[model samples]
Target: MMAFFEKLERKFGRYAIRNLMMYLTALYAVGFVISLVNIQIYYEYMSLDVAKILSGQVWRLITWIMYVPEQNVLFAAIMLVLYYSLGTNLERVWGSFRFNVYMFMGYIFLIIGAFILYAVYGEAASVFLLTPDSLNMSIFLAFALTYPDMTFYLYFVLPIKAKYLAFVYLLIEVYSFIIGGVITKVSIGLSLLNFVIFYLMTRNWNRISPKNVVRQVKFKKAVKMRPAGEPIHRCAVCGRTEKDDDTLEFRYCSKCKGNLEYCSDHLYTHTHVE
Candidate 1:
């Protein structure tokens, strides 16, 4: 999967927005203001309402991303700022392309999860799990897991290791899923799935870093160059070289003289040239 992800990064990396979280944070601010004016306005039009989407209100698909988890204006401001910091740090560590993929993966999953919720409950699953809060929390979780020992000042006073807080959050989500209603269960499930995928991606952050990828490419080229000198094995019967097809296995024939060899395809059938 990392190899496939790298192929995508090479093809599409340049198009990724640098400091993408800044833009997202700005959008979150906009959402916060809009909510202050009228919280119901977003739900009425911008929510990912499948019924509305099928009815041609397709803009909801993209617009629903603006929803922030915080209802209080002050809390929203603080949360946005916190996420902006964590997001920029992640981008610095993983590079913009990787960070972009991480964030967009969450969005895509949220959209898909919204559809699943709709299918399960139709209109009854009104509790939305598509808020930017869940996405940001996923980012924080990734960051914490990546830098487990890193310290965070909880409530701007108590200092604690990020891993501990992440553990607590994980427990809370698990408990919520176990005890919450249908809507809460679905919401938490979506959020956990998004984080799980991202956690897999960032398990070995160094492997995906730009520097590491460049090193791997250089090493691959050097190794390939060494193998270009001459063929190590060749078929005595069909004269097929190892260069022709790597999957073909070659072995020396005991019946043949002068160290003759044959590829797997012709090995058993070839006559001995003694």
Candidate 2:
């Protein structure tokens, strides 16, 4: 799956939207304003009502994302900021295309779940209850997976690790699934399917291991011990240094003049210097 994502990035990464989180944040802001003006109006028109959708209100499919989770103004503000931080950091870690794929796959899973509920229960289904909570949970789960040791102040008081918080939330979700209505069960299962799939695919547990952490710390110290003003080997074309982008290999180009180096990206395609 990661190899498939790599292939996708090579082919389609250029077209991905940068800072996509900002747009998603903006939508939440819009939803907040809409809620202030007339909450019922937006919920009636925009909530993920499959019955209404089948009745030709197709816009609900996309517009339902604008439904912001209810919270006090201060809490909402804090939550939005936290979500923005999580989302942008994930984007930086995963790159634009892969992050986009992760988010959109979550959305697709939710949609499919809703449709399945509608088919099973007909008009009795209330899958629209899922919405923004499940979506937001997925984002949080991804952040916890990526930065497990990162600390947050619980209620601006006690410091707690993100992984612990995520575990608590996961437990709550499992409990909800066991006791909740059919809609809730479906929502929890289908909405978090993205996180489950992503965790399985990336398998980044080794990155958070104590051994890996010590190894990385030692490597950084070694790099820092190097003499000041020493030139680090970097790709002449892309300007990526091994220190910054360890995934890339830099090689001196014998075919090029003036001690030119190139990374794997430009090693072969770059014009040879005379």
Candidate 3:
């Protein structure tokens, strides 16, 4: 377990956002503007009218981000700000390009999942799961798990880690699913499913996301093979070769056989071949 964490830190240490998370915050700002206009057409549009998406009115998929539960501007603004703050951190760490890719994939997955549900269970499941109010909490849950240790001032009184709170949220959702019946369970199921899909795609498993690390290792190997103008043997203690222009001569260490090299200063002391 310790070795596993060490390797992960080495690879993904730079992925923690520095300032790019701000752009995610700004996306929420735009979300706020759309919310103010109260233009919630896509709730019905995406379900029954995806032809609009194919017809080049492509904003339906993206516009759904702006949908809010109530028409309360204050609540919308507050939630947007919070979403932005956490999301931008992820964006900065992952790069805007990768961040957009991840979010877009999540959206696409949700839409596809909705379409399947509609075909199987009809439009009711689509309306229940595809709406902005329904899906936003799933995005929040994703952000919470990514930064599990982050502290938030809950209701401006209780200081709690976001992940712990998110876990509690999940528990309630689970309880609702069990007691609240099929419609409610399906709602929670889709949200959890979306997160699982995204995590598995981005995870370090060799079968899932192998291309990124493979390219890096290939690049390092190419760097190691270049000669430094010296046809020389390698040192065993520290990996270096004697440069051709250097005054000290180097030869394979007799004591170490074909395994080591030594210069003149240590030639006698080190024991080497002529």
Number of the predicted model whose lDDT against the real structure is largest = 2
lDDT of 2 by residue, 153-201 (tens): 9989999988999999999999998998877877788777788887677
- Displacement of residue 49 (Cα, Å) in model 3 is 4.1
Which of 1 and 2 is ahead in TM-score?
A: 2
TM-score of 2: 0.73
Worst 10 contiguous positions by lDDT, candidate 3: 264-273
Best by TM-score: 2
Clashing pairs in 1: none
Q: lDDT, candidate 1, residue 133?
A: 55
Q: Residue 33: error of model 2 in Å?
A: 1.6
TM-score-wise, the better of 2 and 3 is 2
lDDT of 3 by residue, 165-246 (tens): 8999888878887897554665567667777775665553532235535544654575478565644455554444555434
> Which structure is stronger by lDDT: 1 or 2?
2
lDDT of each prediction vs. the true structure? 0.75, 0.77, 0.56
In the predicted model 3, the residue pairs found to clash are 17-93, 20-92, 21-88, 21-89, 25-84
| lDDT ranking from best candidate downward | 2, 1, 3
Q: Number of clashing residue pairs in every model?
A: 0, 0, 5
